[model samples]
Target: MKKNDWFLAAGIVIAAAVILLLQIFGSVQNGLTVTVSVDGSLYGTYSLSEDRQVEINDTNRIVIENGSVVMEWADCPDQLCVNHRSISRDGESIICLPNRVVVSIEGTDGKNEENSLDGIAG
Candidate 1:
């Protein structure tokens, strides 16, 4: 309604746009490695730059190609992990709760300390 109110609205919009752009570009970094874990223990870590398929404990299989990783197969009845999308950005992951398998993307130093909070409870 007022000139100051209009300026305040424009400033808020600009700030929101900048924050959104930062979030998009910041999370777009290509991960350097794919880390696999089973039952809360370290299974293996593979380079994301290399394309290959990995079998985990005969219960799950994953494919890494073109800088992205995807769960190719899983014995779990729900098939949630198998149906999940590929992950290529740092801290992205595909988790198989039935098999207790976690496939995550890590940065160049093979660590994702920043976005480690996978979930939160109210």
Candidate 2:
């Protein structure tokens, strides 16, 4: 209602918007590799820059192309993983619950990948 109050409110709004934009842009950048895991075991890691198809334990197929990874095929019942969109951003993932498979993007810095925790485990 007061002039100072309006200025403070506008400043807060601008600050919040800047932080949100930074987070959005930061998450999608510097993701150079994709890591695949099956049944709680490490399966393989692939580069996003390279085009290839990875078959996971004869149950799921992962396709990497054009800086993105997608589940090309799967033997799981629901097919939810197959329908999911490709992941190219850091922290993005395509998980197949039935087959216990997870595919996630890994950033180049390695700090994000090394110290990350799996919340589902706890």
Clashes of each: 0, 0
* Model 2: per-residue Cα lDDT over 1-122, one tens digit each: 79999999999998778665554554536547898998889898888989999999899999999999999999999999999999887777899999999998877675655433332221
Query: What are the root-mean-square deviations of the candidates from the true structure over C-alphas?
Result: 6.4, 6.7
lDDT, candidates in the order shown: 0.81, 0.82
Residue lDDT tens for model 1, 1-122: 99999999999998778665554444437547889999999999999999999999999999999989999999999999999989887767899999999998776652334434321110
List TM-scores for all candidates, in order.
0.70, 0.71
> Model 1 TM-score?
0.70
Best by TM-score: 2
What is candidate 2's local distance difference test score?
A: 0.82
lDDT minimum window of 10 residues, candidate 1? 113-122
